[model samples]
Target: MGLLAVPQPYDFERSLDRFTFWGVDRANVWYEGGLHRVVDGREVRITPAEGGVEVEPFDEAIAPVVRKLLGLEFDLPPFFAFAQRDPVLADAVRLLPGFRPPLAPDPFEALVSSITAQQVSLHSAYAVRSRFIDRFGVAFEHAVAFPTRERVARAEEQELTALGFSRRKAEYVLGIARADLDFDELDTLPDDEVEARLTSLRGLGEWSADWFLARHLARPHAWPAGDLGLRKAVLAFYPDVTDVRAAGVRFDPFQNLSAHYLLAALRYR
Candidate 1:
């Protein structure tokens, strides 16, 4: 077992809530109060521990992957300071102390997950995504690794549809998998450039691009304003704000974390 040190004011369980938010995500399995996920082709069971988390059957090389999974790179002190200025945020911070937004460790998985979530209830999304993972993902002892782009690239459109994807969504997933675009290069591009590049693709839109920046790259200002849950969460706190996307400007540099906190508050409420 290996212990990963976390920054102060980190809530291990709550940060992991998003994985199971829709229910029974195969990529991140919550079992026996421990989170199980594939790390460098090996399944690691993680549990909350003092000042951080404990990883069983840990490999030193995969520590970075584990860190990303826990979202340890995001500094919360600044966000906490900003929260004090807003009544709603202040209350949320107080209610859910140590809350940190988690990231989707894999870039492809992040985009694919976002695509699956489009226009459908998250519960429905989970069902479809779980099916897709089970069909193509490599199975480990406790968790399933999300399918590689190569695996999906070879998948037939009808096969994806049979797995519960809409025809357009199946095309989108396949299109992305087969695209010549290099995901690694996307990490070096500016947010607007990334958005432009991804939106240039057939099915990816501003919403999917925004989430990619937020969840995969961990870009600070990436606010997923088009999300229905975010809209509802914002309305619950600031009913006067009509356009959530426009209101995103107020969140400024911490918009991504702010959006997450608001959604977490709404979910727990």
Candidate 2:
């Protein structure tokens, strides 16, 4: 086993709490105080340890991917310092001291997850997504590798609809899978350009693009003001804030982290 040392003031379990329902999570499995996922075709389990988490059957090759999945690379002190200036944010920080936003490591998986989540309750999304993954994803012992775009591209719209996707969402998923956009090259673009390219696609809109920047690329300034949950979170904490998108400016360089922290507070508090 090898250890991945996340930054100090990190709570491994709390950071991974989003995956608490192991049964519904296909790509990642969180159970028995460990996280399991297929990394480079091999299933690995990560458990909390002294400074960070320990990876069993660890390979140097998959270390970076693991770090990305757990969001271990994010530096928190600066964001913590910034939060101290605001009472609402400061209280959130105190409530969840060591939280880190778990991320979608694969751009394709990230986009697909967003597509699954659109206009649906998260529970319903998880149910449909779980079925979708079972049908299309490559199953491992404890996790499922998300279906490749090529696999999705080849699938008929009816097949996706059968997996619980609404007709339009199914069409959108197929369109994205078959679109000419190179998912890897997206990270090279500026946020505006990224949003432009993504929103130009049929199914993806500004909200999906914003989350792609925040959750997939980990862009520091990405904030999804169009997100209903985020708007609610902002309103709950900042009653004076009516426009969460415009209010995003207050979070500044740490907008992405601020959104994550605010959402986390709503979930964990």
Candidate 3:
């Protein structure tokens, strides 16, 4: 019989709390006993335990991350109102009970990951990234550590491509690593200046830069004008999503939160 163990250390819920706009589809958590992140895929399963929750797939540590993400405790104005009548969106999100994803907190990794994800399937991206990480990243037991510049800088372009990364992505990753400026320096700059610097990389685009800010830096107003999901979700709902610069107006100030709202909303249909 399984002995009851107190949920300790790992906290997925708390991690989820800080991000109001999480790409976390609880189903996407790669659970092989240890918590992992899966791209563009989602799976959810939970069973009862003697003293606590017996969650399948998720590791003990994942609980806090889940709670943190589901930290939307008190209802906000429009969000509260919106949740009241919208059954579709509500149904998809109701299970969370309390979710509050923190703003983006990993600018470098976020940017790099987004670049790898361009026009690719989620699992493919995850697979490619897993290999890249296994090769270049140092072992990180406490939490996932972002790859070091030296590791990335030292890698050959072909090696990355062989791992499913496109030449363009490989170059971009190397370019970023090789650049004199990095997160330490970039963090000191203002948001616009930081974005400008990152955009200077070979494969980086305006959209990718914005994604870095919105997802990793937690820029309140960060918006991705070129996002396919934003456009599709907008068109699917408001129908004015193709308005380009103005397309971002739908969720201006809280564009980051808006992404979450849109995703939560889209999950309805």
**lDDT tens digits by residue: candidate 3, 2-29:** 2223232223443343211333322233
* Global lDDT of each candidate: 0.90, 0.88, 0.56
Give candidate 1 regions above 4 Å deviation: none
Please provide, for model 1 over 144-250, each residue's C-alpha lDDT reduced to its tens digit, 9 standing for 90 to 100: 99999999999999999999999999999999999989998999999999999999988899999999999889999999999898999999999999889999989
Summing lDDT over every window of 10 consecutive residues in candidate 1, give the lowest-scoring window: 7-16
lDDT of 2 by residue, 97-167 (tens): 78889888888888888998999888888888888888988888888888889998999989999989999
What TM-score fits each model? Answer: 0.97, 0.96, 0.66
- Report the CA-based lDDT of candidate 2 relative to the real structure: 0.88
Best by TM-score: 1
The list of candidate 2 runs beyond 4 A from truth reads: 21-23
Ranking by lDDT: 1, 2, 3
lDDT of 3 at 183: 75
- Quickly count the clashes in candidate 2: 0
Higher-ranked by TM-score: 1 or 3: 1
Which sequence of candidate numbers ranks them by TM-score, best first? 1, 2, 3
